[model samples]
Target: MPALTKILIANRGEIACRIQRTAQALGYRTVAVFSDADADALHVQMADQSVRIGPAAVQQSYLNIPAIIEAARRTGVDAIHPGYGFLSENADFARACQDAGITFIGPSADAIELMGSKRLSKLAMIDAGVPCIQGYQGAEQDDATLSREAQRIGYPLMIKASAGGGGRGMRLVHEPGDLLEQIRTARSEALNGFGSDELILEQALIEPRHVEVQLFGDQHGNLIYLGERDCSIQRRHQKVVEEAPCPVMTESLRQAMGEAALKAGRAVNYVGVGTVEFLLDARGQFYFLEMNTRLQVEHPVTELITGLDLVAWQLNIAEGQVLPLRQDQVQLNGHAMEVRLYAEDPTQVFLPQTGRIDTWQPALGVRIDHGLLEGTTVSPFYDPMLGKLIAHGATREEARRKLLRAVQDTVLLGVRSNQRLLAGLLQHPSFISGQFSTAFISQHFAEHPCLHPHVPCAEELAIAAALFYQARAQAYRQPLAGWRNNASVPLHFNLGLDEQQWSVALDAVPGGAYRIQVADRSLALQVIDCDGRWATLEIDGVRQRHAYHLHAGQLSLFTRPGSLVIEDRTQALVSGQASVSCGTLKAPMDGAIVDVLVTQGSKVSKGQLLVVLEAMKMEHPLKAGIDGVLKRLQVRVGDQVKNRQVLLEVE
Candidate 1:
């Protein structure tokens, strides 16, 4: 292949920017392709040139092969890099790049085709003497065959999409009764997400550690492993935290796993970067899962420990260069950990969030890979992961502490996120001791305080009240700060948050201090300084600073518990209107309606499945909140709906 001078990144968001950074550093001009929604995205601005591929939808944009190739052709680029996600693991995409005379900076299309399917990859691994779980990977994909096979495999088996990864198109069936339903759902999801509904079954390993070995190979028949990462910290089968050098890995175990991973790579003549995932049980036995045929989202941890840039290595390998280092020469340095910062609401079952980012303050002394500006709008057209926070240290404890502080200090306001949950998990005893598995979140975080809805405390309310008062005083340019016509009377204000209201009274004291009362608690507050966003306050004699953003009567404050949004409703009119009936069902977020389980005039129970909305590449089933007859249905199976739009009405 000719030297790669100008490369076109056929993706968007952080990964695109990440690849561009590395490519530009290596004297390679980079081109970016984006959808209509991402025309003003950070990645587009960072690239040397950009092309509009298609509209906001993935099928018409990022996943549109012809459009991506045409963009590359139009830009006169020499190579095309499909950064993870959209078409990263797509074999046809790789082949198209190869056919278009554009070097595909990845493994061979044959390798991608072989390993993209869980079923096919497992069969090859078994034939190559690699350890694999006992299950069914047959060609008969009929529901009856899958059900019978499930019976033979016993209860507690995993239904996995052959052409899927990233936790999609997968389900765990704990009983025989739910096998068929899970298989159907998994197949449907797999079909929609991967264009193939083929599935495989395997015995679910209980309390197993999710470990993966990073492998790199070249066309010169050389392959090596760059250690392993423990991705056991996950939720809904998606990884939340990843770290390099498995915590419990012994020298022998590492060697065994690495050799097995190399063997899997060699089976398909893999080149460039790939990962072999496995399930490491408590007994030191590991079984092959599937192989990811591109740079992983968790690759930063490996790069930090190995002291090598994987993307640069990928570029060199794509240029037909030999492996940068041999298996024995590979050295694993200190410790490194990374956490995925997602745009989600922990209190609302981790639902993906979308809105304009009002404030973007990344933590110092860490590596943050994200494509976000202060005013960037996070749309619902893609994944919810905003970026990653990575920390490297001489020890695991150091890395953990640094990551915990980063999670707390990095402020992202104007939208809900899982910041508190990430902080809690980082400091939790189980995580601190490195004693965790893939079941960590599901087993322990269900009722954890960090995941619960936060009700603002008296101190927080007082701080918000003070900020609100200061904003009003500034708005009116009060001649005398906190001055009142009636000196003996106090100022009353009402604040609202999360549908709850609080009435607070503030009494202006001498020397620019105020005594605030919320419910039964009273505190003395002195605003040392206020700049509209950051404020220094002496509350009850405790001097500290806090971050806040006030816009249109809504004050977003960063407190000890988490980010809170308090609305100043003191001047709002009091309405006697009744609340909307519980029978009304609305779309939780912007998404396409994929399934309508009930028709108009159908009798539905309180918990009956009403609709399945597909958003952020996941399916969410909307259930009826009250028992009633379905009086109206306003959406069909392929209708795109907006957030809070009424989907149905039950009378």
Candidate 2:
């Protein structure tokens, strides 16, 4: 495009801010597009200008091509950069950009179309002599064809959406009995998430390492691989942890994978930045996965090691600039690792969480890429990923340790997250030794203590109680706090946490200390100093500092294990209302009811799927908690419901 001077980021969240950082540094005025839900998002604030695209829904906002093109036109931008996800890989969106006379800082539409579909991409890779898993990628996608293919492919096959990525529309079936139902579920997820219901079957590669090669190409046919990243640490097919220069990679294997990736790129005449993923087995054999036609979320690790700005390269290539470095000139440096910080509750099957961010204090030693503020609300309208924390060191162990410390030190309260899980993973012996695969989490940590719901220990409870008492005393200016007519008398308090209640008694002692009793445990606690948000406490002769945020009668405290939210209900009146019964199924979070499998009054066995709720772009099957009749059905397909809203009741 005529020496592009202005660019519009056709995306949101951290990726948009990431693009803006590079584009603005390169002297290009940037434009940001936002939906109504993201009006106050950090990305919009960072851009030189912004335009409202549509509503909160992805179909009406980020995925709306015409609106984005119109945004570019109105901003008078010369180029548009589609960050990963949303319309990044949509061929029609690329074509729309080209037709609008705007430079699309990515590969051609034809290339995207070819690589976007798992079936077409696998077929193309096989033709290009790249090793591929034997699967059914035929054009015929009927139930019979899929069933026959499943039998031929044998048991333990994967049913994947042809146009899916990030784990959506994918399921692993272990036997013939579950094939049809899985196919139906996968198809539904695919159609909802990708606008396509095409299905593909692949032989499951048990415990394979999911590695990918980053490829950068120019208009002059100069393409080079920026090393590879090991993304085997995944959950539900979505990558959680990624590190550069695959942990088990040798020079020969790296070269082989890099060459295969280049071949795949060349077959489609690829340009700009892209990634070719592969499944590397234990026997040193690798098979082609799919190619992502945009910058990846894990690109920061590659950048940290190579000392290169991939976004700048994309902009330069789009402006007809030649590759900055040839394949021979590229160099890979030290080790780097990254962990995605997701707004999810790991103890609750990693259910996505949404709430206002009361505190967001990122660690200093690591590089944090996020779009968060103190008051930012983590809505359920988008992905649960809050941001990423990346660390670089001269050795793999150093990187791992640094990342682990960063994850522990970084404070993010208010909403539930997987911070503790990340810390545990980093400290695991298998992960520390780089002896893990995609099944690592399920195999090693399935029953790990960190995954279980956290109950406040004596120390944690004492800290919470002391902090709460101090805050309340200071707020009320109670000079006679903990004072009683009899010096031996103790102050009584009640606290609630995780739907459980505890009665605590605190006795004032000399030297500003207190003896706190929680259940059968007693703690000698003393609040050394407090500045409202952070407090240093000494419990049982051990001194420690914690970050805390108290709001709306709830105190969110960051302990050594993770974040704990406690409420002081000492003065509140007890309600006689009964709690929700086990037979009542409530919406776990805000979501739309996608399927109602059981009608009212229908008999259902325990563990039967009753409803499927689509939230955070994934389908969560709500199963029967007990065997009973469906006495009441309060929701149906297409009905939007809020968190804790009762969906049905089985009596």
**Model 2, 529-646: lDDT tens per residue?**
8897899888888888999998767899997546999988898776422222357788888999999898998999877888998989988888875788888999989999998898
Cα deviation of 501, candidate 2, in Å: 2.2
Query: What overall lDDT, based on C-alpha atoms, would model 1 receive against the true structure?
Result: 0.90
Candidate 2 pairs with clashing backbones: none
Count of clashing residue pairs in every prediction: 0, 0
For model 1, residues 1-651, the per-residue Cα lDDT tens digits are 667799999888889999999999999999999899999999999999999999999999999999999999999999988989889988999999989998999999999999988899899999998999989999999989999999999879999999887778899999999988898899899999788999999998998999999999998999999999999999878999999888998999999999999899989998999999999999999999989999999999999999999999988988888887888899999899999999998887787889888888888998999999888899999999999999999999999999888999998888788889999999889999999999998888889987777888998999988888887776765476556789788888899886579999998766668899999999999999899878999999999988889999999998743589899999987642212235678787899999988899999987678889999998888887678899999999999999889899997
Given candidate 2, what's the lDDT at residue 215?
A: 98
TM-scores of all candidate predictions against the true structure: 0.89, 0.88
The CA lDDT at 372 in model 2 is 88
User: TM-score of the candidate numbered 2?
Assistant: 0.88
Which residue ranges in model 1 land beyond 4 Å of their true spot? 478-482, 580-651
Runs in model 2 deviating more than 4 A are 478-487, 509-511, 580-651
